[model samples]
Target chain A: MSARRRLSLGERLVIAAPYLWIGAFFLAPMLLIAKISVSQSVLARPPYRPIFEPSDSLAAIWAKAQTFSFDAYRALMSDTLYLESYLSSLTIAAVSTLIALIIAYPFALAMARAPERLRPMLIGLAAAPFWTSFLIRVYAWIALLKDDGLINNALMALGLISAPLQMFATTGAVVVGIVYSYLPFMLLPLYAALERQDPSLREAAADLGASPAQVFLRVTLPLSREGVIAGALLVFIPAVGEFVIPDLLGGSETLMIGRTLWNDFFSNHDWPAASAAAIALVAVLMIPLLLWERARLADEDDAR
Target chain B: MSAPLLSIKGVSKKFGAVVALEEVSLDVGAGEFFALLGPSGCGKTTLMRCIAGFESPDAGTISLSVVDLSGVPPYRRPVNMMFQSYALFPHLNVFENIAFGLRRQGGTRDAIDARVGELLAMTQLSAFGHRRIDELSGGQKQRVALARALAPRPKMLLLDEPLAALDRKLREETQFQLKEIQRLTQTSFVIVTHDQDEALALADRIAVMRAGRVEQVAGPMEIYDRPATRFVAGFVGETNFIEGRLDRNGAAALVAEFGRIPCEPGDLPDGARATLSVRPERIGVAREGEGIAGFVENFVFRGETTLLRVRVARDIVLRAAACHGERHAIGDSVRLNFPPGAGTLLAEET
Candidate 1:
């Protein structure tokens, strides 16, 4: 008799939970930041002029909105420092992601191809870095990268160098820090993709007269492409907005937008400019995200 | 097995302490549909892998047409295998998957296309050439795997349980189709399977392996009618095993628990303990005859045929298969006889 269907309360909650969480956390903060990006920076408390007040009438609010300053946006456009910082961040992230991918791919392949009993231990080892404090780990790199640090001492002790290398406070050191910290993020996805593949496929290719190199190029590479893309995105997205690594490792010359945003917020007390920079970084990250989604949907379509 | 296309001699492989294969030797002739049949842990699959060069034997030489392939890698060997999972590339289309081997072997585009197109037609998957591997059905994937493996026209093809994933109906249909393909292509095939019916149906010769050793290697009917060992007798088909002792002389009655059963002691000494391996279908069941009289203790319905367990004496039962139309209830009096040339005398297993 009850032909028409209605979702129960529990069913509705289960379906609505994710959207609610995203709306409350992700979208709301984004909207707040966007609003701040258009406001005028001020020397007074809170560092930015209020676009609207609770006591303002509708007409007063409308007038305030019309006079809202676009100084932060205009500053980002005209200043070569902001432009160079953005470019530097993009280049550094791209370089670090590539380095992490190159280093993690073989390690992941070795773990996946290890004996069955050893796989769990290997995968656990890949995730072992997460157990340690990330801040302490980054600080550890500082000790190694300083002018008279452990690395320079070891090289001198080995008689491989006559003097200490200028490793710390350089762009190379920042790239190294980013690669080291994001290595696991790059490794786990690749391991999953490689491990999920049927070993018989490699054998099948080999049996079909493909050499080891050929099998790797034709079968192994093409199949793990999803993991490659996924791992690249995971490392690139976070590295683009990385704040601590570049700050600790690079000199004042390393112009990353993330450090610029940090200075605008904490040191200079330019909240509007910082919000604008943060919003621009988010916009930059959207390109890779949209491309990732398109690839995933295309894969699903092929499967269908 | 003269001038075999694939010859595996004294092949031995071990996994740590487990002996997967032990000095196994087999020869597959040109155009022969050979099957390695066994239960789990029987090394049939290990032997197949050794032949395909996936797992190298610790000590052996596999020769294809007289070339010793001792340390040849799987890629260097001119042989192909159809995996049980079909293992088709998920990213490639059907035509591309079939053409992969040809491309690896280095051929012109037109030549690879012609070969792939011809194979697609042979497998009746011409319309599905453009379909992605995941988009096709299981049977179509199986055909694609077959076509892909056969693209290079290797000296031999190894199939690892080709129909193990299909249902019974499809398995039977594929059996005939596989045999037809083998015949049409004249390709020597060495298929490994745990299903006896599959081996019996598709193989020209069945090599029954047990515990890392080949127990018997013979034609299907020969293996059924004349099993060389007790393990082969029990494994290949359903049979009624009557344990007994041979009389003082040859060509005499076997003194069993029930009564004196006539049997030929092939090579066993007089007074040697033996077992009369009589196939269920070989025994005749009738209402009255000059055979041993017994009461039907139980009957198992199997489609068109019914297997009747007749007790000739107390605790002495013998299985006899009859047509489903033959109505025989429990406690019905009947006579059973093991016809001549149907029962084989095998020595008791050690």
Candidate 2:
């Protein structure tokens, strides 16, 4: 008789699939980027030097790796442009996430409280933006924000402005673009949290002599906190690394780390510097992301 | 009871085309434990919600101490409800959940703490005050809900199937605890439940409802022993319904398949069809010469009581609930008789 233990091949394969996918797709690329970030940039075949050649001996490879420099990262630190860009990207992302949250919360509440029959349609509408290409959507924002475009024209026609206001290529325009694109991300989780809430909680609050505003403040806001955090993270993470929206709709004066990275990689051909910037961006994002995950685990434990 | 503390008058409500409540009126005296009992979709819950001010009636007024409560919102109303689901705040600890109503009323910190501590003791959840709501058991959560609803010191407390979430044994235990709490608080309680046993056990008076109307309202014993309608009789407990015709005009007797049986007179004309509703316990095995003869068709042992079905003359079956020690096998010859005043004659439902 066989011993009554050990996983079967199929079970092992199923269990290992997600880890393998993350290892191959995420960790491997990250390691490669880290390796490239430490290498010297030169006008060469791969645009970077000191490749870990297959023919090199183990000792030779180790010795060559030791010769790797922190020049790219050091250059980024020495320049205030990178620092300002990082700060600006963080600020813009924070502002946009807050705005999206404020705007999306009421809409999410409305969707959650909508009649059951209409809920599916409301969700479909929230998700409808994903059907179109994100690039096309950002480009469409440009047409509306430009001085000669629809918004300014409408303002002029309605006698709201004279000599067409400077509407395009501004920080405000970039914020609008990011908010427009990420509003759905901010809305869906909130709707899920609110919708799953038992309506009786509100009634129970009211029954306890809490006025409408007090009920909202005491019960509704605190209960949907999980969704609020989830929605904020969803919007903030991508907004921090957003490239296309700022490139299309923002002015030259509005500096973002994404645009800086793009310039390093494409315009200056500084592959190592761009890789360093990417790593820095990842490091900046990791702290909050880890905190959020820990909070989620703690919440699950409390629920159990 | 003195003048009713809460009076609901001519309250009618409709949801689109469907009538949820129809001119429902009820009076709840101070410190009375009242129950709205019915099957699902019988408007018991709707009536409770109306009283709680969650749903407004389209056409009438609810008064507390003779003050009309027409436009008062739920938050402004002097009432609180323990929801069927408990609805304990998942984000708050037991202490905060119980203290929420007091905090909303803007009490001083010390007063809030004292009140919450007192409620925690009252609900027997003093140790659980520090525990998160999600960490509590179902029974503990129910106590938290009860404590939270009672913290505001409302004029009336409403419970929507407060014990519906518990298992049978726990439900029975909670029913007694709930009654004790109501007595101790001296606050009028209006509970809505579909469970007849719960209503019978916990309530001082029960309003049995059907399809958006109150069918009968009376004490438990009255509802059980002397139901007003055929619906109430069948709905509350097990009974043997014997259809019969009124033969003689005045003595209040029914001529059924078994034989002529004495019954309480109802609203029925001479020679009109009626039903003799006799509780299963009222019928007993009698001597052959004294009562109608029948054979025991089958019997079921129900722990405390043994139920037997007897096939009498004309193949008519009558159910009798006897004590467990009374042994009767299938096909055993038996005679059944109804004790005087044991059965009631109800007019045949149209």
Candidate 3:
């Protein structure tokens, strides 16, 4: 009876809370960035020209919006720095995501196949890094990868290398840092997908004359595909706009869009250029992800 | 049995301290429909898995057509098992799932297609061959699992309670279809089931197991009419168990208040305690008869035969099945007679 009843006022408000939070915190800020991206930067307290006044009527707001500038977007096309930073950011994130997938797949498989009593401990171990601050974890990589860091010291003491290797302040170091930081992001989804698989399916495949390798390729691999998609997106999307790992570990030449955006915002105080760069970065990342999400949802609909 | 297709000898398996199966041995004849029937934890499934090569026995050997299978892996063995959950691959359509084993064996596309097409027709799933697994009904999914397992045409087919997931009417239909498929394919089938009626209906021979050991292995009629042990008699069908002492000549069992019930005592020593088992239908009930007289206590309606529980003495009620012979109300006087060769005397008590 209660399930069929109409929602009360309190229930309606409770259900609307999450949508309100997203509109206020995420959508409003993103709208602000978009509005600033189309405006000219000025030598004023706000830096960028205000698109509208609070007191402006709808007619007045429409009139003001027509005069908005595309100068920041035009500047972005003329300068190769913006284009190269975007390309580099995409390339680095793609590589790091690929590396994370390779390492996390086997780890998640092993965890899923482990004895039941040991599973809780394995999950806890994977999540332990989240308890520590993310920045501190990235900085800790410096202690391990720097010229006189623990790795170099250990290699030298073991007579494995004649001198310290240039492990830090390189693109390779940045990739390693990102892969390490987001290993859990890739692993949790893959683990969930693999764990949800019915063990009987594997047994049935083998019984149906599938060799072990064939079983993995035909059954295990195909069944765990949803996990692969979720994990790859989780690591790729955030890594595209990452600032701390690239800034802390990468050399000066290893310029990602996040660092370029930061430089435009802080060093040059060009708010319009930084906002435009941020919007472009989101567009570049969201297009592929949204396409994949659309395809995945369609598959689920067909399943029903 | 024409010839033994699969043979298991003195196979023993233990999971830590618990013995899942102990010295279990059996043979499945070629083209014979066999069933391993038991309650949960009775080792029927364990024995089936050992034959399938999913589990290795700790003590003995399993062989197919006289070839030792001690180190043979499941994929290499000529056996396929349809799981209890039906375990159909969700990612593949029905046609692809059936063709999975064939693809692994690596034949031409046309050959695979022909075989899959034949199987689809056999299972009456030709129209649904392209449907996704989730889009199919529960009964349809079960048929898909069966068709997939049978595609490879292994020497022996193992069904692990394959019909348990279906509803009552669907299960009955699937059971008939399963036996039909087995007959058409001429594949040796070893189905494991806990339902006695299912085992009795489908299996050519049944092995009733208990506590990790075989209690009896016989045909359906033999198992019902002539169970070798007390456990088999009690588990297979409804029967009245009467604890009594073996007569001096070991020809009959002397039940205390009900007098001597005639039974073959075999090699059991005279004066030894024995249990007599008599099927309800074996009992003949009439108002005026030369037999034990008791008051009808209760009635249970079973369409063809109505079962009447007759109270002979305090706390002593014997069930008699009447087939449109006589009608008696509760508290009505009735006479019950155990027909000639009607009861089995087992030396052990349940």
Model 2 Cα interface RMS deviation (Å): 1.3
Task: Write out the backbone clash pairs for model 1.
Answer: none
Residue B311 of candidate 3: its Cα lDDT?
A: 91
Tens digits of per-residue lDDT for model 1 on B29-58? 999999999999999888888888888889
- Model 2 residue runs over 4 Å out of place are A1-5, A43-47, A298-304, B247-251, B266-269, B303-305, B323-325
Best-matching candidate per DockQ: 3
Q: Give the DockQ of candidate 1.
A: 0.78
Clash pairs for candidate 3: none
Ranking by lDDT: 3, 1, 2
Docking class of 1: medium
lDDT (10s digit) by residue, model 2, range B296-333: 89999998988989888766899988776778889988
Error of 2 at A3 (Å): 12
**At residue B110, what lDDT does model 3 achieve?**
97
Model 1 lDDT tens row, A1-304: 9897999999999999999999999999999999899988888888887756789999998887886777898899898888999999999999999999999999999999999999999989989988999988988999999978999999999999999999999999999999999999999999999999999889888999889999899999899998999999999999989999999998889989989999999999999988988998899899889988998898787776
Q: Please give, for residues A150-175, the per-residue lDDT of candidate 3 as tens digits.
A: 99999999999999999899989999
**Candidate 2 lDDT tens digits, A1-304:** 9888999999999999999999999999999999889999999878897888889999989888987899989988998999999999999999999999999999999999999999999999999999999999999988888889998999999999887888689998999999999999999999999999999889888878788888889889998998999999999999998998889999999899999999998899999999999999999999899998898898788766
TM-score of each: 0.94, 0.94, 0.95
